[model samples]
Target: MDLNSGAGSLDQFEGGDATVRGAAVVSTRLSQPTDEWFLEPLSEIRIGATEFSEPDQKLFSVTQFVTAAGRKFSVPYAVATRPARGRRLWRAKVPAAAASS
Candidate 1:
């Protein structure tokens, strides 16, 4: 998905497979949107949504990044809003060993 910078301009990324395989999740909280965060490579992203009284709604997109050294960073962005913010949505990650198969 292409992530744009701003407020309330996020494209709808909901209503599909619970988990988006090979998704590019972006982070809008950095000094600049870099490939490591914006162009998230080899990441499995999950999309979620919730309604909070009328027009107020929030959508979540979560992904984890693993570096060559094995460091992991779980990044979750509120994709419902432009300039996506970070919000934790309920989810569990299957261990790499178990997911390999």
Candidate 2:
């Protein structure tokens, strides 16, 4: 995939159907099959990122995804060409009141 920072340039990450040879825990969920997906980092791996300047121009922060069977995939950048609903989905915080309930 190819990612544009919306700063006039693009960043790219490439991966394919191969076994991810490592012992790291990660999780991902797709709101829609083709629109977007969210990656959660349960280990010391780089799951996602966010650009502080153009905060509203991001979609998802995840740079890659590795399935439970070890298949790996990647995107072009940290952000997508759409509006993100939350700030850094990978690192998002839950309200204390909501958590306690």
Candidate 3:
């Protein structure tokens, strides 16, 4: 699920499976379009949309960066966009943890 920069260009990340074993979970925030926040060595992400954030007050739209072994890591923007803003991303972690939650 690619992130929307909100400026009609896609900050694309390939969709990844959450249930895969040993998947790496990463926490990320949406930055302004000018801030090309690239994940080094991680050959993933696409582009679309843009928005500007205030310098003093940084807004973090947190989301799950899920990736299983031998696959590309991705930012789950669909879940990340629930509130359309702010830090609202959550991962159930493991099945047992999900059940407990």
Residue-by-residue lDDT tens digits, candidate 3, 1-101:
23433312222212434322222222344554535453422222222212233562333333323332335323332322223432212322445866699
Q: Give the worst 10-residue stretch by lDDT in candidate 3.
A: 42-51
TM values, all candidates? 0.24, 0.20, 0.19
Score candidate 3 by lDDT: 0.31
Q: What TM-score does model 1 achieve against the real structure?
A: 0.24
Best by TM-score: 1
Answer with 1 or 3, whichever has the higher TM-score: 1
In candidate 1, what residue range of length 10 has the lowest lDDT sum? 2-11
Q: Give candidate 2 misplaced runs (Cα > 4 Å).
A: 1-45, 48-62, 78-101
lDDT of 2 by residue, 1-101 (tens): 12233211211111434433333332323355643554433212233443333555445544443444445544434444543332211222345998899
User: Please, what are the lDDT tens digits per residue for candidate 1 over residues 1-101?
Assistant: 33333212222434434533343334555775455454334323222322222353544344434432344554344444443333322234567998998
* Evaluation by lDDT, superior candidate among 2 and 3: 2
Candidates in order: C-alpha RMSD to true structure: 9.5, 15.6, 11.8
Ranked by lDDT from best down, the candidates are: 1, 2, 3
Error of 3 at 52 (Å): 15
In candidate 3, position 14 carries an lDDT of 26
